[model samples]
Target: MQQYNSLRADYKFTEEEAKILKDLQPRMEELADQFIDEFYDYIWGFGQTAQFLKNKDIIAHHRKKIKEWFINLFCGKYDMPYFMYLYKIGEIHVKIGLPTHYVNSAFTFVRTFVLNSIEVHFHNKEQHLKEINAVEKIIDMNLDVLTSSYREEELSKFLSLSSFEKTILSGLKKFNSYVNLFLAGALALVAFFAIGLFVYDIYLLFFSDIGIEKGILTVLGSLLVLWAAIELIHEEINHLQGKGFAIGAFIMLAMAALIRKVLIYSLSSEKVDDLLIIGFVIVSLAIAYWLVGVKKKANSV
Candidate 1:
């Protein structure tokens, strides 16, 4: 489970077609045999896949059900009910401990299935072939959706883990925000100012002091500040529903503060050290943000 979670790097889907696929997956699973036979023939033609199919029973089993996931690409309408099917399919994969490599290889079978099906269905009709080609292009766009749904369904417990992480992160973010408003506002301000100060320190340390090689610690510090600013402003960008932006924001802010901390101690001034200590306090508060920021904000009913 941990391994699966680690493989997924927080992607999302918003298309109604993805929802449709989710809902229709179980029914498609029932038609797995039809898909399997076609897919096996297709895979057997490929030397690489043929080598992997040495175990006939195992190959047959996956072929029978992988088709369920294939047809799911054509299902439209995304909603909670549809997600239930996605979740179920994911559980099935998990129960069987499906290998990640096989998941990728299985897509090759799907592509062949789709192309072969279209080719055979419209071989004699040029007009039908053209139409089918266009539709197949759209289906290709949805390949990722089917893959994600299947993987998610296979790892159903991940939803719970994500939910728990989100809950803890949200509470932490909220509490940090309040603390920042009170005890860390000055600290944040000092850290902000320290960006320039660190740059000066870097210049002085290398040229004026005992020839210590100063890394781009100052530049890194500035970058962190810029990153945090970007996070705070990312949602205002048009057409961004705030999922990727939100996660990016959290990561940038944390990184900015961490880089700033490294800069603070690198300086020689007592005054700078004092400011850095304060900045550290603020950074600590900011880092705590992950605790509360994981969960999605509740929509008003």
Candidate 2:
């Protein structure tokens, strides 16, 4: 019913269609492995998809898995758990950066194979129409739900990219692509040295400046600042490489800096106003993050 509500609402899947599918289960079981072999042979013939199946061992293994999955689709038991499983499949595709167009095109191939097989097997035109319609509806339902997962994943990437886009437009606009690349390389080198300094500061704190609590605080705070810069440098690298920005990552970095400040000095400092201001800033940042989420949701709608 979960799958029904989420996907079948569009397809109008009925118990009759479900029964037709289940009745074909035996034939599907018989043909699945053979069909999948032929299907994959076609896919493997193409360089674009064969590249993803780099491992030879997984080729047969995944073929078997796809056969099983394909047969189970006609098991007449589609539900929330089934939807969840398909959702995970979609997420894996997104995680691997599979293009959505490839997903749609692959579904078309499967749909044609199954529908043509049905047409050949059934004798009565009306019965053939009925059964094929059931198959077509179910395939479409699967596509709808699966593609929705892809869309959700793309939306997330889009949101993160918007942040990176803003940063690139703000600072890198004056520089050509080559100059931007040069600046990123230069900053990356600086970040590497800063990390080295951070490591050296650690040596100073423990061995060279033992028992000096303020010295330890200074060293710790410096390390934290360097880490923050390193985070920005990574963002810059991703920008240059045309990757999406993770805006929330920066928020976490900011929170880390605040926590470090409080840990190293603010907690023990005698200034009440300073502590109050820090508290206020933390609260404001939390509120701001929440508001951004709300606004993003609104904008998406």
Candidate 3:
């Protein structure tokens, strides 16, 4: 209750805003079905909706809950019960392992939907602006409470851990951070060497007695390796910034290196067996890379 009051105060959500929302309740109730229908359409685009909704019964129940929640959004009763209801919903989301991304994205759709509905229904400019502001505050507050569950969940887990365990966990986290930094540094070095390799390839192409065709192919292969190294470096940087580890980037580097070998090996008929092996390895890496991408996409959804 204290926290709820703090949230309301933080948003400066007052009785006036609540009354304004209450005034909009009837219109919102009328559009509840439409909101649910469109909401389903929007969430379905996430591609993993079925993973949560599962059967028709579950989906039907979910739809009903969503419609109810949508209507309640405008209930204009920003009291302990209302906020408690939101907290419970957030707990359910955390229990079901729903990604906070989905929650945030779903709120975005709700905000846009309600604002558009307001524009279509409201005529008075002043009242329209007031309603919009109130709706925005409510929506933002709801999102804040919802995401807070995830934060609290993490906090509780840490709190539950023994002091020694907490110390170990903290150390492991720092070690992981350091490891990621090391990887980023290593990738930088790899990129530097790749640049040198590219430069050397170019030098050999221009100054050496190598055949023009082989020289061009070698340089192109070197460029491919260099490009892959740069991409890996970019991926590592993103990982350090809290993005997923990019296994695909490492696979790409391997494939690029093998492809360069293939380009050079193809010049010598005697290296046909080696070329075949490299081709097989590249194909395997390609498959692994594709799988990694698919997994990442699924996880994001």
Candidate 4:
């Protein structure tokens, strides 16, 4: 519910700082592309960071957005809408699973870029120190607004849940907590056995009574089902711990379960209609998953 007016109070952003930043508008616009390229190029140097952006189209699309944001920073309108937009940038980054370290690192990078630009363009002039001061303030304000929004967005989740539900989770008795711990241990044991079954799966495929054709499909199917089971146990444990599981994982687990079904039914006595239904379920889940991912990416910073 907080607006730019309230948020600005936290950063002490003033009209003087805004006016100074506005003066840099044309200069910022001129160097926007250079800034963006340097930013992404630095990001690309890190293999793990580059991997998520493997899609050329995704990279290009985001590159354009970053440049626009860079240019707009000097537009001098650090009002409510601008604040919300910046907040969305942070939220989207969270939605897509980007870690907090990257967020902090990126802001540091941008702060350096702005400070360097100020130093280079206004070197030794009377206004040089003033410009640097203004730039520093604005960038620091941006970092505050953006990172705070990310935390607030996540905090809102815990806030919105029912108090009764929260009470139930927090009120666990010693006996109940111990029981859940025991259940978690049992699930881990099952998961360990599941891994061993994978080795047995190979044995069944090549050397057991099941012939190659049937063995391959059935064994793979069984392994997938076991994997799905393990995933469920993980989520259940997460639920017990009050950490909540992501819906994204469940979608993937469902897809895996369906694929396992198809693998099993392909070689067995299953009706064609049932196979078709399973295929339909898979396609539906896949479409849902794709839509969810796109929604996340679009909303992500």
lDDT values, one for every candidate:
0.54, 0.74, 0.91, 0.77
Give the winner by lDDT: 3
- Residue 100, candidate 3: Cα error in Å is 1.7
lDDT of 1 by residue, 1-301 (tens): 3322322133333343344345445655555668867666765554455444558797766665556546645555434444455556545555565544455565666666655655664545765555444444434443444356565663565466677787887799798657545533544465566566657756766767434534455556666675566445543232133233344355556667666666645665555766666676666656555544644332110
Q: Where is model 3 poorest over a 10-residue stretch in terms of lDDT?
A: 1-10
- Winner on TM-score (1 vs 2): 2
Off by over 4 Å in 3: none
Indicate the residue-level lDDT of 83 in model 4: 78
> What TM-score do all the candidates reach, one by one?
0.31, 0.52, 0.91, 0.53
lDDT of 3 at 191: 87
Expressed as tens digits, the lDDT of each residue in 228-261 for candidate 2 is 6677778777877877554644664576567566
Better of 1 and 3 by lDDT: 3
Task: Compose the digit string of candidate 3's lDDT tens values, residues 157-270.
Answer: 989999999999999999999999998898889889988999998899889999899999999999999999999999888888888888899999999999999989998989
Best by TM-score: 3
Ranking by lDDT: 3, 4, 2, 1
Instruction: List clashing residue pairs in candidate 4.
Output: 92-300, 92-301, 93-301
Q: Candidate 1 deviates by what RMSD? A: 14.3
Who is ahead in lDDT, 2 or 4? 4
Please report how far candidate 1 places residue 183 from its true position, in Å. Answer: 19
RMSD of 4: 10.7
